[model samples]
Target: MMGGRGEGVGCVGGVGGRRVGVRGLGGVFEDKCKEGENEPYRGALAPALALALAPALANTHHHNIIKLSLQGNVGHLVQQHAICHGNLDYKLEDGQGPVLMTTVAMPVFSTKNETRNRGILLGVVGTDVPVSELLKTIPKYKLGIHGYAFAITNNGYILTHPDLRPLYGDGKKRRKPNYSSVDLSEVEWEDKDDTLRNAMVNRKTGTFSMEVKKSVDKGKRVLVLHNDYYYTDIKGTPFSLGVALSRGHGKFFFRGNVTVEEGLHDLEHPDVALADEWTYCNTDEHPEHRYLSQIEAIKLYLSGHEPHLQCDKELIQEVLFDAVVTAPLEAYWTSLVLNKSENSDKGVEIAYLGTRTGLSRINLFVVPDELTNQDFLTAEDKEGVFNADHFPLWYKRAAEQVPGTFVYSLPFNTGSENKSVVLASTAIQLLDERKSPIAAAVGIQMKLEFFQKKFWTASRQCAALDGKCSISCDDENINCYLIDNNGFVLVAEDYTLTGKFFGEAEGAVMSKLLQMGSFKRVTLYDYQALCWVFSESSDSGHTLLDPYFAFFSAVKWILTELVIFLVEFNLYSWWYSDLTAKGYNKGKRRKRMRKEDG
Candidate 1:
């Protein structure tokens, strides 16, 4: 949460002394932007790339010049020059003409001394022979290459590179190697124990034991293979097989045991009970084991499917009847009027009920004629104030329409000094409602000047008898009596009153006056009541009556009393009945208590 220490009518300082202006009522949803404002431009990729890459290669020589500068260099110097040129000539043609090219060929080389003579002699001796004869010379000479090719041909096809085959042979001449005799059986065989007794034991078990063991091993191997295969299939790659196998064993042992035990337990005790006997069966091995006797009672009530208990039917019916009888009469009138006047022109239609203390009491202000069809309102027309001087007339009209509720407009203060006095007086009046007459008088005076200028400030200050006082904006310069909720006056000024009223008061009486300064928004009717009760009281001089009287008076004056009345009389019955219908009597009781406390 954020905290602050000053009170004013306009902007206030927030965290880090940032100013946040007070937003007026009804400004929460207003838009701040004007229509047709152009959005700012965002940069494109071409401009961004040009900006990033243009500077680095701004001044460099061509590759041809760099190459020519180091054409005949040697050692690291030549290598460095070649690298610095950084050029490749892949095109067949030069700058002006086709480039020359050359080719060099060498006879096939072999590492063995015996095979070296064959390659050289065969190629030299057959230089004059036709290409076909030259190719056939190696096989006719019973060359080792020819023998190798024959061996591969007689056995199976030789799986060597295609380019090396001319020195070997075509498929018809050479025998192929028998890769089937490569001894894969050694890789496949299983070892046996060396002890004779172990061998005899193995024989007695027969090929049956070996076969069973192999089958069991094969089964385990198949399981592992499937685990690996499916594991990689899901994950899209292979992981550690050992870790997977270990995890699989753990799951099997623990989960399988649990499953078996649960199955057996379920079979042995098929109709076990639950802990909450009211909601479920209670058949567990404990002292409370029994058939639920309340089941029939619950079913009987639930059968109707009405959200009320059998015992609460009367209360529910009574509530429905009360709602029908006590529904507000104004709501019905408003609805009927709205329906009939759907097409009526809108205008200020002030309704008044009666006159009291020379004031025409208002009931409602009807929609105005010109504003009904419009969507926008200027600052002067914002609060539907058509004429401030005739506000009492509007109140009188509204009063005529609604009988019980009082309606009136707050007086508009003007003329600098007088305005401050009026506002200070209003603030003092509000504080005075809490039964502190002297504080109210002082509070009004403290803020007289500022209020005159249409600026309001509230502050805490110390009072006599160790109490606190608050100086609110008001007309007079009174400062001694006003106090806030914390019993401190906000104005820092000398509080010695020299008036005849101050001289008549005793110390305790003055303390009571100081205590009264902490009130907020006291009404005339309540002040009259407090005066009737405390004006002649002695001893503590009405100080004891201040806090309690203020609290009760606030409850009566504010709409909060009506809200509490509605909750207690209407909402409580409805909620309790609802809970009772759902077979939750205890819940209903608790809900009633909670509603009362709240």
Candidate 2:
């Protein structure tokens, strides 16, 4: 995870304080042409032959002349022809290292001019900046920290050419084996990041960080920031751009849009109310209590479905109904239920309900026979339901539009034959002090199948109150249908469609793109969404959007550029003309024009 730092904005300071200016470099390269006048040059074949052989290197300036000279089969003597004698060495740090510098003397053996005498061009004509000076490209990001920015070649070579002794090595005994020209690909003993390597090959643009175990600071993990940039001019070449920032201070810079995490900690409104409710519900003081005998009394009054246990289901309903009318279940977060598990005497079953603050897990019921002291679910069992198959089932309930009940069977075995049991729930509205609804949920649990049917009735009542059309069935395979804006079936399934309208997704996805920085608002269309897993699909894909945002963005960009052009033109006119003569220039020009006309 990237560490949090406040929002900031900075730019790459220009490549200023250059060792050799443009004019100086140009003068050195053109000195030979300046000394002599144009002659009838007849040694064109010699120059042509040289070009044919070293076409890639010919007439191009590079970092090392020795490497370049060796590449072309032309044998030439190289020596340090000191031009910027004092200026070159002055830039070196500490000034104790060898003047690791050199120049060249090319003998002009021509067939036309001065054939007998060996006239030599002494100056190689190039700019040489110290390695220490090259390190300036990396800038410090914040105060009270040592943050250095550097650049590497696409192949992970240190192209900026930092002194290997201090940066990569400890400088005492263990010196890095010529890291100045080495690529990470050649290092077998160290961990070569495949991520950084792939970024160069694919020419990606993004920011990433990794720990550098090879650092001289042993055991102290050093975080290195790798910010990839794409260079259009060097596209498809053997080089890619990578800016490596040394993060000694706990700050990492992301290149593009502000992420949710980046905006989270520094946001003025942190949404603490919902967070506090979640945190409180996660921990509390409680002892396991059973009210089965009290709840069973009311069940005998309601019509009996099974041959026995009729009284038990009725009592559970009255207990839930009276609790809402009299007792306040401030239930801002998830409800919790304590139970005995297969391994432990007491364990919690959590049902998570997500609100504005955060998604919370609460299990509100503990049934006697359903799961009495089997040892709570093991860690492996909990992880099984965290995947795409089971998680979406949980999402439908936690982020419901209306009061709904879903009969989902837990993986645990319940009956004497060890059959899996399911829970049917009746959702009740939880209200705030203003009597406004905060959440819709009911804390009722039962094993009786007859009482379970009441959950569907309660669902219909809650749905009507919440303005949702719904249908229920005993056969689990049957599903509900909704209508789209076009009156077409929103989702096509085997279940019968009796709803007012139908639509499944927002609409078919549109291929049209939006202009840069266009505002796209989220919209919701009401439909009877089926509450079963078979009805829902993961990664449903995108929805069709109108081209309005893209159209507007183009107009904004054009207008902005036109305005900028006009403003720049006016500014240039003001700066170019003589300020003192501006007002009187028209009058003076008119008099001069009249005289000329006369």
Q: Write the per-residue lDDT of candidate 1 for residues 107-151, one digit (tens) a residue.
A: 222335675445332210001111121121111111110011100
lDDT of 1: 0.22
1-598 per-residue lDDT for model 2 (tens digits): 0111112111000011111111211133111101111122222222222122121221122334445445432343222221211111222336343332212222222223453245344334334544332221122111101122233333344333221222222233322334243443332112345665555434344445554322111211121232211111012112233333223222322122333233222221211112211111111112211222212222222324323332223222322333332222324322222223321322322232322112122333444345532332222232212211111222323222234444232322122322222322333334322212223233322332322344445545755576754445433665433322223232223222221122222122211111221212222211111122246565743433436766787899999999999999999999988755535588889999999999
The TM-score between candidate 1 and the true structure equals 0.12
lDDT of model 1 at position 569: 87
Q: Model 2: runs farther than 4 Å from truth?
A: 1-95, 98-123, 142-148, 153-156, 161-177, 185-195, 198-240, 245-598
TM-score of each: 0.12, 0.20
